[model samples]
Each structure stands twice: as C-alpha cells, then as structure tokens.
Target: MIGKLGATTVAILLSGSVMAAAAERVEVFSTSGCGCCIGWIRHLEEAGFEVTNENLAMADLYAKKTGAGLKPGQTSCHTGFVGGYVVEGHVPATQVKRLLAEKPDAVGITVPDMPAGSPGMGESDEPYEVLLVARDGSTSVFARYPLAEDASR
Candidate 1:
C-alpha cells in the first residue's frame, strides 16, 4: 500500500509540472507600433500563457533583444522571456511549453525572420523551422512546420 501511494504521488507531481509549464508566465518586449507583436501575444494568451507585454520604443526593444543574446539573424519584432529562456520572434506556444518542460541547456528558441506561416503571421503554404539557440549563439532546428496538416490551417 505504501509503495502504491508513493507511485501515485510521483505521478501527480509529474502531471503538475506539465500543467505549470503550460500556464507559465511570459514577459514580452515589443514596439508599440507592432500589430504583429500584439497578435503573437494573443496567441500566447490563448494557449494559457500569462503574458505581460511591455511596449518599448524600437531602439529600446532592439536593445532588449541584443541584451538577450539574439543575433541579427535570430531577431524578430518581439522577444519573450519565460523560465529563464529567451523566446525570439513568432515562436509557437507549443514549442514554448516544450522548452519549459524539457528545460534545455541553452538560451532558448527562435522562429527568426518572421516566417509567413508562423503563429502571428497566419497560415501559409510556406514552411518554417524553429531554432534552438545555444549559449554560444549557435542554433539547431528544434521544430519544423507547415506539415501536411498544418499547411491546411
């Protein structure tokens, strides 16, 4: 009975961790004139993220992205911080949740260049990749999109 109880408790804790990640608080920095950034924030909110949007001037927003260690090629209109990870550009909320759950040993993930089919940009036949940025600024393909199913949406 004690062993069964222990197992159940562990399962509960694991499930709770996933729930926490899904509902994590995200802080976003973007320019006041960016409608796309607002759309991205709405995407996060709809996905259960607690979003705090801080609209800065373009210069200040650029500084925040640079300070977060995002290179020119890795940048987008908005930047987000969550669970100590820097989320750049139009990264989907599912990838953000996965990052929090996996707790990778890196900076964060980025969509880069604002792909047309990305969450904020709406649907398209064009595909895009989400890159996981390392501490040294190198990136790897973390996720790819415009799958057969996704392209329809």
Candidate 2:
C-alpha cells in the first residue's frame, strides 16, 4: 500500500508540472505612455497568461522584428508575442490561446485601430474583428466579437 501511494503521488506531481509547462508565458511590447496598452496586459494576466511588458519608443521596429509588417492605419497602442506568434493591438486573450492551439500558417492576430469594446479600449460595447495578419502584408477575418461580449465564447 505504501509503495502504491508513493507512485500515485509521483504521477500527480508530474502531471501538474506538465500542465504548468504547457501554458508558456507571453511577452508584450508597447509604448510607455500608452495607458490602454497596460490595460490590455492586465487583461491577459487576468486570463492566466504570464505577461512581460517592454516599453519602447520604436514600436514600428518592434513590429517588424516580430514579422508584423507595419501597415498604414494598422498599428495600435501595443503588440505582443506568444508561442511564436505576434499579437497586435487589443487582441483578446482567448484569441491568443486559439492561435497557439491552432498553429496557423500566418504570423498572428491583430485588432486594428483601437476599436471600441476591445481588451484595453475603454469605449462603448461595440463589435470588432480580429484579423489574422500574414507575413506578406495580407490579412483575413480570423475572429469576430459582438458588442459587450467576450471573445472566449
């Protein structure tokens, strides 16, 4: 009985460690002066993602480094990287998880133009779409969210 109990305990511990390692933390890059960016980081943290915020001036350069082609009117207050994907603007945490799980061919997700009801934007509840931006400066509809509704659903 003692040996069996010890084996069970070891199995449980190993499973817990594996679960923790599966959800890797995310890193976010945003300008120091942007308040909404901070809010977005908080949203990710609340969703169980470990977030690292880097405040820098050359956001355009950062975007380029992450394979996010800087396009006119596509830039936002912040950008993030997770599981080898670039997350731009107020992308919902659930969408980030989906990107990691689905492992699409594209670069990552984006929510252009601080739209209302996004993760950080403190505007009225309005519908928005998260675009899947590819490395070749192409984008397509990835996900859409309704007004005042959470993207996780």
Candidate 3:
C-alpha cells in the first residue's frame, strides 16, 4: 500500500509539471491594420494560451528582438513570442505548442508566405509548413499541417 501511494504521488507530480509547462503565455506583435493577425491572436487564446496583443508600427523590431527574421516576399501578417520561441505568420497553435514542448535548438518558427488556412487567416483548413528559423537567418521545415487543423479542430 505504501508503494502504491508513492507511485500515485509521483504520477501526480509529473502530471502537474507537464500541465504547468504547457500553460505558457504568448505575446503577439502585429499591425493594427491586419485583420488576419487578430484572428491569429484569437486562435492562440483558444488554444489555452494567455495571449497579449501589441499593435506596433515597427513589427520588424519585435521580430528582431525575438530572433525572428523576415525574408522578402515571405513575410506574413504578424509575429509571436512564446516560451523563448519566435513564431511568424499564421503558424498553427499546435505547432507552437509542439515547439515549446520539444524545445528545439533553433531560434523560433516561421511560416513564410502566409497560407489561407493558417492560424488567424480565418480559414483553418489549409495545409502549411512551419519553418524553424535559426539565428543566422537560415530555416528548415519544422512541422506540417493539413487544412482543417486548428486550435479547436
């Protein structure tokens, strides 16, 4: 009986740690004129993230601060900072959650050239790739999602 109680305690502690780690807050920087950015913010909030939205004229500055880069023609509507990770464009909340959970050795994530169904685009049924952007401005494919994959779906 004592052994069983000890095991239960350990399991409870492990579950608490996982829940605490997953309940991280996110900060999003976006232009006020972009409606899609707002939609993305909503997406994050719905995904159990405490999101704070900041409308700024110099989003590039925020991007640089968070170690996110913008490639010409690949730039999207907004940028986000979550768990020391940078997220660009309309990346899905699930991918962001995965990044935080995995804690990759890169700077952050990006989805260049915003797709229609990405988070915040208001169309959550499009396939897209979240690219892992490194500090040196190099990037690679991080995660892929099909259309209809959203925070709720």
Candidate 4:
C-alpha cells in the first residue's frame, strides 16, 4: 500500500512539474534594439513565463509572423511561440495565459502593431484590440480594451 501511494504521488508531482515547465517556456523573436520588446518580455517574466529571447531582424520576425499565418493587420513588433501556438506583438501575459488555458482553435493571438497600454506601452489614449487569427487567415477581435475617459483612468 505504501509503495502504491508513493508511486501515485510521484506521478502527480511529475505532471505538475511538466505543466509548470510548459507554462514557462516561451520563445521570443525580436530585434536587440527594441526597448518596447524588452519591456514586453519583462511583463511576461513578471507573469511567470520563462523567456528565450532571440535576436532577429525585423524582416525575419515579420516573415515568421506571416509564415505563421498572421495577416498584415494581425501582427505586432515581436513574435513568440509556446505550446504549438504563435503569439504575436505585445499581447498581455494574462491573455497569453488564457490562450494556453483555453486552447482555442485558431492560429493564435495578436495585438497587431504595438499598442499603447498593451502591457509595455505604458498608457493608451485609444482603445486597442487583441485579434484572434484563425487558421484560415480570418481575424476577429478576441479581446478589446477601452481607454478610460480620464486618460489615466
């Protein structure tokens, strides 16, 4: 009985470790000179993601985004991959977590061009949308953030 319990506990622990490791693994492709990109990375780190930063030309990143099925309007400054999904632009870490958790049927998510107040841009004067890029290349708003009337609100 003791041996069986030990084996089950070990299995549970291993599964938990695997899930944690998978959650932390994120590969980011961006330019070395982009401060906002770094800021976004920091946001991910704060949200418990382990980042693997790769220095690539802007063109390369764009190519990867396009290759990953991101349309022109459905792209941002940086590109990331985790759990077989492409993460584009300055998408919030919470959204990213939700993406992993929900495992939606689509290409992945994008914040389009770097939007203000979207995790790394500080404050946004206008609303922004996080788009869900479908496998067929159609995009729809997955998440919308409305700017507060007070500007700082």
Error of 1 at 43 (Å): 0.8
Which whole-number lDDT from 0 to 100 does residue 48 have in model 1?
84
Lowest lDDT block of 10, candidate 1: 144-153
Candidate 1 deviant stretches above 4 angstroms: 1-23, 148-153
| Clashes by residue pair, model 3 | 40-120, 125-147, 125-148, 126-147
Question: lDDT by residue for model 1 over 14-131, one digit each (tens)?
Answer: 8998877655999999888788888899998888889999989999999998898888899999999998999999998888988998999999999998889788897676888999
Each model's TM-score? 0.83, 0.77, 0.74, 0.86
Cα TM-score of candidate 1: 0.83
Cα-lDDT of candidate 3: 0.75
Pitting candidate 1 against candidate 3, the one with the higher lDDT is 1
* C-alpha RMSD between model 4 and the true structure: 3.5
lDDT string for model 3 (1-153, tens) is 558779889889889988775557888787777888888888878888888887877756455544455555445667778787777888878888889889988778888766877776654556778888776777788877773444452
User: In model 2, where do residues sit more than 4 Å from their true spots?
Assistant: 1-23, 59-67, 147-153
RMSD of 1: 3.6
Q: Which 10 residues in a row give candidate 4 its minimum summed lDDT?
A: 144-153
The candidate that achieves the highest TM-score relative to the unseen native structure = 4
Model 2 lDDT tens row, 1-153: 548779889889889878765555888887777888888988888888988988877845465645555466556778787877788898888888878888898777889889887888875557789999877878898888763356432
Which residue pairs in candidate 1 collide? none
What does candidate 4's lDDT look like per residue over 1-153, in tens digits?
A: 648779889889889989878865899999888898898899899888999989887788778888888888887788999878899988888778878889999999999898778877886656788888889999888877753432321
